[model samples]
Target: MNRCYKILRTVALTPSIGPSSIKIVGAQYFARAAIAAGEFNSTRDYASPFDADGHGSHTASTAAGNHGIPVMANNFNYGYASGMAPGAQISVYKALYPFRGYMSDVVAAVDQAVEDGVDVLSLSIGPASVPSGPSAFLNVLELELLFATKAGVLVVQAAGNGGPSSSSILSFSPWITSVAASITDRRYNNSIRFGDGQSLIGTGLAPPTIGGVFFQVAAAADVCQRNITAGLVESCQDADPFIRSLVRGKLIICTYTFDFESEAATIATVADTISKIGAAGFILTMDPDIGYEQIKGATVTLQVPRVILNNMESSSALWEYYNSNTMRSRSGIDIGFRATTRILDGREATYTWSAPVVASYSSRGPDVNNALLETADVLKPTIMAPGSSIWAAWSSNSEGDQYIKEQNFALLSGTSMATPHIAGIAALIKQKHPDWSPAAITSAMMTTANFSATPGVPILAQQKNKLSPTTPFDFGAGSVNPSKAIDPGLIFDTYFKHYVQFLCIVPDVDDMSMRRAVGVGCPSKKTDWCSDLNTASVTVSNLVGSRKVTRRVTNVGELDEKYIVLVREPFGVNITVRPQVFKISVNASRHVTLFLVATQTANSYTFGEMVFEGNNNHVVRVPIAVYVSSTLGF
Candidate 1:
């Protein structure tokens, strides 16, 4: 299901309005220039015409620009949030429109960005999957993205909120950049409370024949009331025991429903009904289903003591009891119910903005549709960034809603939240290498990426236990390392023409229909093979052509900087960098590069360093694998 739930959140773009919102534009010519030129500009002037969401500003500054804050962007100007590039300029473009023409406008804006000389374009929006039509709306976007590669623009798009599964498809443009959002170990404090109101309370004592128990039935819309009010009252299927357990005048346990009613109306109804019925508090169960809003119709009145069951903890018990045939037959002392005026406070729970792994909501890769899959089989999103509970500029026009008063800052999640980080980094890279191609930039960042685990921490699920490192489904190519990307010794560069050639080699793709899907002809593999296409080809060339790219560091203790580098084509690869000594000058820096030759497979390698000693104080290892064509059977 294209739904968001289970700690997974989406980064949705707010409706474009004033300062609090995002405005999008078209980029019809952007991608083309990026591929051709391999270089662009990233100016950092806050006073530009596009002063949209501060999200871009924050991400830009952290990844590349020179913003001077420590908390939000981490003071590096290109610090914590400083993307792969630490010294790039920034160009702000506000081309997004309201919900109505969002896609068309945004795509056009991307084209425009290329025309305006933007080397990288980042988008935080996504399309809904409607199956009854073309493969999916995103598939169409993929075709348009081809124009970007032709234009030499590197497009970074966010993975959708539909996640925890591989069903979701990232935008399938060969040259369009795709990114997924990851949670960090950061948190924020917030709370929701129930209001007070009159309530009906039911009281009943358990009989010796049955287990000890007390029952209550006080509050708005109890079971009996719902049946009778509906007139054609059936015996409230599967609800008799729940009802009989409650006493006539005491506290009664009942389910709450207010999703359909306005917040104000629901509150008013609860107050009036509670006063008339006379009841105590209530106990509510956490929802098990997933969605943008998992808890629905949960009405808690402050007038009564409300008890909440952590569904994660109580689900097992509820399931066991619910399945018992004699649950309702258990005898108990019959105690009359009662009505009363009482109040209770709501429970408080604060959620963290960052946690390990991708939010259970960000979409996955392996774009279906043979015709569309050919361009880039690269797993999405291309990388991960902070998209959970990120604080950014909020629209000023949203103050009218009772639940939300207009504020300068707002918290959001989703690929929308991560895109700005990459865009900012693009600017930084531009600042350093004004003539670098989008491919060169992306390749540098991806190749230099590391997959080392943190010290004193065991990989865990729910903060406990450890799993094997092969869990690619959860940690794609491991976590992203921006610092390493800037200086990646080896790169896995991809070009638009090469990606298109892969599509033609697919056994099931309909060549005639491919044109309709991507607006391009499939290259012929026979005689006039596309292997010679004028695209940037990535092959397993010798690091130094037998020269062996090597370096020496002599300022440290006599330690074996013993290292191992291997390429696993598209399947598995490993890279290790070990220092043989432990002694070094306090104010000196050391550097080295591990190289992995690329094979004919469209894959990349990861790096890490296993601790030879028990002290756990060594840098992690990494692997260098570049994506290559398997047509020649590498």
Candidate 2:
């Protein structure tokens, strides 16, 4: 059996025997059958028929191997050392051809993993952006996954590193468990320092003004006297030479040329050039969309130790500063460039800092459910986990390859890291209860899952930035708690039959009110598809009101024991559980009536926990909701 949350620490109980317990059906990756048959190297070439790369190797290690080490790239691996289910056996069957694109690969992989007897399939890769349903990949790759659910196999996919919004259609699918990114380390970066407190908000060089002088190189005397203005002629001015001269300390005012998103690279190039030429600082101007002679560069600040100026407005501000002293402060602002980590000596450079939160360029989602969100049905990420600066096993062995160590690993981030955690967790649950079906496993997770690390605290909506009670959206059903998941109080127990029912049945207000009884969505005005009770349950019970209600329930277990039933009020509804006692055992059952009198202002009253113990001890809670006045109002 797979050791829960211990994939990389040690060899599994029967490492030599391998994971013969789990079976892969559809995809070759999940089947590792070829390896069992002495067909391939389980770790090095998991994605066979396609040349090997390092990514798949690390993933396989955490999913099955017993050892690992860290490595860095433009990225790094970030998350727990071992995956959620270390004991679960894994095999990578190559479906999509290498570099041919993911369009056909995803479908073939899923189909074969199921065929290979894979009880659980985990996919760490996804499209770069939220996919539109109209896209070919969506129609082909994603649609095939919809069929995987019917096959009784659990499918998990990465939510995509692109934040908040990545849980949508192209990248996220309802059939797959979407994963999100979170931070493990609280400390992100060291403070940035700049030399000479006096900073400039540099402007960009435009056509005619490209010749304007801004600063003199402290080291180059003759070059300082050189009237670089002559070099500003339309025929002579090119971005390269102009940027080069500026680096040499002939403070060249220039116009901003690419997207602000590339500011980090742009500044790095200019700063490196200047440092090489003995220049102290730069006055990078932001003269976007203007002519040379007609426009003056705007100012922005560089966080580097270099004395950089920020160009907020026009060069007129600099002229005003140089020409006058009585001015307290001109309208100047600081503009910063976005930066990425620079790895030196196998670690991030000290001057370089890890980004707090996620990169702004990283897209966010589920805010306004588009195609991706619709496919996900808003069941996503479930929760965020460490996805940045990650190090994982790799495959390549070429001399000059980035991933070549016998214990090859590389750093990476994105939903890729997040998906493995869930996959591991699913494996653990399967390990513990081998007889449980996929729906039972998923239901146990969704219902019993804790929804928040900080309970009762509100997290603002990503897009709106508005503070509201966090739901499945912010921290889906609370973050994934493996320990808690192992023993969920009440499992939802849904099946594909329910999915078919959802497709065919139309629920009435009774069904509508029943849905509102649970905490999925608002009450429907009339019968609507949103009120589908097929995939979920229709809770019905009278447990509302501030007044305490008491009742009794018999224990139904193999042996005798004591049972206690309690209730905690939902929002706006005040409630208290009156003490009750019931004792029974061996094929017998009991019932409890929790009396509740909801306050007039209490809009909706929900249910709480019903504790059980003794010979048959299994903690469980039932969901019950009471609407205010019962007069339908949306």
| Weakest 10 consecutive residues of candidate 2 by summed lDDT | 6-15
Error of 1 at 177 (Å): 2.1
Q: Write the per-residue lDDT of candidate 2 for residues 332-426, one digit (tens) a residue.
A: 31121111111111122222332223321123434223332233223444444455445555544522232133334544454555556666677
> Which candidate gets the maximum lDDT versus the true structure?
2
Candidate No. with top TM-score: 2
Q: After superposition, how far is residue 349 of candidate 1 from its true place, in Å?
A: 11
The residue ranges of model 1 lying beyond 4 angstroms of the native Cα positions read 1-99, 130-140, 189-355, 371-377, 399-405, 450-452, 455-475, 496-564, 567-634
Residue ranges of candidate 2 with Cα displaced over 4 Å? 1-80, 95-104, 125-143, 160-175, 186-188, 191-384, 394-410, 458-469, 506-634
lDDT for model 1 comes to 0.38
Candidate 1 residue lDDT tens string, 1-634: 1211111111211111122222232212112222233322223211223323334433333333333423221111111222333334345444322111234434555555556655666665555552322243224455556666666666777666666555474553435556666655643211112112322221111111112223333322233533344212111112232343342344433332333222333322332343354433334333344112222223221233444333334433332332331122244222322322222223222354333556555565544333323323233445556565554443333322121223333345656666666665555555555555666666555443333345544232111122233233333344556565554433334466665665555434446756876677776652122122221122121121111122222212123233233223233222333343343442233443333333223333222222122122323222222233332322
Angstrom error at residue 517, model 2: 33
Question: How many pairs of residues collide in each model?
Answer: 119, 99
Q: TM-score for each prediction? A: 0.52, 0.53
